[model samples]
Target: MAKPITKIDEPILTEKEKQDQSLKEVLQDLSQNADGIKETMQLLQELHESGILGAINNLVEAKEQVAKIAVGQMLRPPVTNAINNAMAAGGLLTEMNPETTKKLMGGLSKGLQKAEEGLQANKKVSVFDLVKLMRDPDVNRVIKFSIDLLKGLGEGLKD
Candidate 1:
């Protein structure tokens, strides 16, 4: 008859053995992610070499002071005005029709170019010249557009 097989009793690990087991597990993990660890080390090295790490460390050290300064600057009249203006512009842009805005911008650019040409030519506009220009189709179109724009602005203000 064949010999009967028996289960062995589990043995308790000693402190050294436990430490060895943990080290082995850590080594296994490091081996598995060796490439990632290497890339991370390289990135860290580059950051350190570029002095960015030191700068970041300093920034962290003075975070509260830096924050206070930034807040103070933001609270200044000019900075607050700029922020408010930017927000207002953003709201205006959101409400505007994209196509109409694009057309208006294009027209403004062309008008600027014409104005530049007039400036370069050193031509002075007299009252008679102004009356004559008013008769021009382009000038008449722009005038009508401006009047309509003003009327719309007035209506918006009333609301």
Candidate 2:
């Protein structure tokens, strides 16, 4: 015999049932988000042609700045001594010839300062931002310039 229809199949939800439905939706969303992150990791690993270059460029700039500091420290002791003395002079300004010394210090200090700012700024770039820049004309131009620079060096070697 055909089974009788039952109230158990009625279309009504208890409070707990409603909460369970909401929780399931939230879990599904979280699962999707997690999947998205895994995809991004896979993409990053496979494609080194994106903002990775930009990050390297930033890192190279930072290294150049550090190199400046290292190089500047080796300057004529007289100049180094002057900068040190200027700092010791201490006045309305934190130190004397701040601008001059800063200039002398070069990109290393500037890069370090920028890094400090970036760290403190806590700014985050989204994956969308990365993709956008990777497709940007200006970004492509810079990438091309970098490639041309390497090609020039290679040609110089062959010549």
Candidate 3:
């Protein structure tokens, strides 16, 4: 308290001291994460044994060639077409009501089940049987749905 402090002196570390300090910190971290390091080493050993590590190394070494080949493959007509079709299908799916799609899928499953049962029965359908089937609530409902779907499709096509 007799003299007022005018300046502070900070300890300046040499390059060698800085490197040594860094090594000490790294060693401390390694010791703390010994189990994780061991697990990683084991995984690396397994990958090396399986030739995957070598493959990965090669891939890294020839990254430009690999990228070119990948891009070439992706740019192929069939691949591009598939990607485009998938995008279109995704767009169409988004526009469809989930509830309606779910209902349609459920109905389709039930219809398939009935068709399978009919196949097992091996029954022949006559004109009278067709008339009788047309009167069936399930058949009628499906016919109505099909007609409505066609009408909507036609309307969309007009646009």
Candidate 4:
């Protein structure tokens, strides 16, 4: 025996009916967001009035050419060198101890302050004055620190 036709087994819509339903849904969505669409249009109009929108449109149209030129520039020796140097510096910073770096920066600040004060005093330093200054604990400490720093730098360069 053949199965009987029922409403649940029927086709939902014909092709034309489906297209009309889709169009109605799209129109409803547009109507619901009409205010947002208007705001977006106004923003785009302002950008166009300022000439930026036109420039952006031109850029987009020539994107392939622009991208090729940008890639060529980046591949040039100087640009590549800068990129490499930045990476090396970044790697060096990462390897360094943060606390030591902070301490060194703080010491440099203090040293700068002292140097400024000395400059303001306008005092001439004789050989004897230099010897006397070396006797000062802070000066002696900094001299030792500088010597050690130079030694370490030399060792690193030897590699």
Candidate 5:
């Protein structure tokens, strides 16, 4: 006689297991949220303080490569006209303006570095510190400034 697979006797998860599972779930949710909010550029300072910006730097470099290459890429999906329009609208202004572009990229890179750092730091930081950092007005202002500066540089490049 063999026990049925549907409801074999299985011990309940212990408290430690439950705690660990809950933490994992919460961390997953935070990671998803962080990815969605990476554009906001709010966590730069903390992330730079930590050392995980190197990983983000790697991702940025990889994206640059993809943008530059079309090796064996399927062309079944033609580039949409709308995307073409957007690219024209955002054509390289840094073409003859390397200095401005360099400064812009430098600042932009630092801001993103912080965000990557934040994601790494989040694993070790408490919920309270996270909330405080998220809600801080200073952080909000800096992100806003970054957004404006980037937008302005992009707009300048259009001519």
Candidate 6:
């Protein structure tokens, strides 16, 4: 029988060997993810071809200037007014009942259609015709709504 083993020897890797092993593992990983790498390269190539990549790079480099310009533009009177008007409109919309708004919009659509028909007819309205219109329930309802709206506007203006 051979002599009983007293020591177990393990191989020790040199620094160069360790580096080579790491490189090999990296190459193996690259091979495994070849499809993903190819797709990424293709997308990069498309962005580069479109000049978007350069634009993005310039934008990144001049971020401060771009930001200042944006802020300046937003501060202009017309832009500020637009933003304020939109905010006010949004606030008003939030305060209004959706059902009432829907009804008003529907009424407006019908009113516009009728107005168009009236325009096409090109008929002159006499004082008597105006008086006759008061007898119309639709006309009376609109008149009442207009009066109420005016009253509310006047009340708001008082503040």
Judging by TM-score against the true structure, name the best candidate.
4
Candidate 5: lDDT of 122? 73
Model 4 weakest lDDT span, ten residues long: 3-12
Q: TM-scores for all candidates?
A: 0.71, 0.23, 0.82, 0.84, 0.28, 0.78
lDDT of candidate 2 over 1-159, digit per residue (tens): 998866576688999999999999999987879978788878876556667857876878799787888898769798888988877675535644788567646745775897899899999989998889789885686578679969988997994
Candidate 6 TM-score to native: 0.78
RMSD of 5: 29.4
**Local accuracy of candidate 4 as per-residue lDDT tens digits, 5-90:** 66576677999999999999999999999999999999999999999999999999999999999999999999999999999999
Query: After superposition, which runs of candidate 5 have C-alpha atoms over 4 Å from their true positions?
Result: 1-77, 80-90, 94-96, 123-159
The pairs that clash in candidate 5 are 44-114, 47-117
lDDT score, candidate 5:
0.75
Model 1 lowest lDDT segment of ten: 2-11
Model 4 scores a TM of 0.84
TM-score of 2: 0.23
* Candidate 3: C-alpha lDDT: 0.96
Candidate lDDT (C-alpha), each? 0.96, 0.79, 0.96, 0.96, 0.75, 0.97
Q: Model 3, range 1-159, lDDT digits (tens) per residue?
A: 589989999899999999999999999999999999999999999999999999999999999999999999999999999999999999999999999999989988998999999999999999999999899998999899889989999998994
Error of 2 at 137 (Å): 2.8
Q: What's the C-alpha lDDT at position 80 in model 3?
A: 99
Misplaced by over 4 Å in model 6 are 1-26
Task: Give the C-alpha miss distance for residue 86 in model 3, angstroms.
Answer: 2.3
For model 1, how does the per-residue alpha-carbon lDDT over 1-159 read when each residue is reduced to its tens digit?
Answer: 988869777898999999999999999999999999999999999999999999999999999999999999989999999999999999999999999999999999999999899999998789999999899999999999999989998998994
Best by lDDT: 6
- Candidate 2, residue 130: Cα displacement in angstroms equals 1.8
Top-down lDDT ranking? 6, 3, 4, 1, 2, 5
Better of 3 and 4 by TM-score: 4
Ranking by TM-score: 4, 3, 6, 1, 5, 2
For candidate 4, the clash count comes to: 0
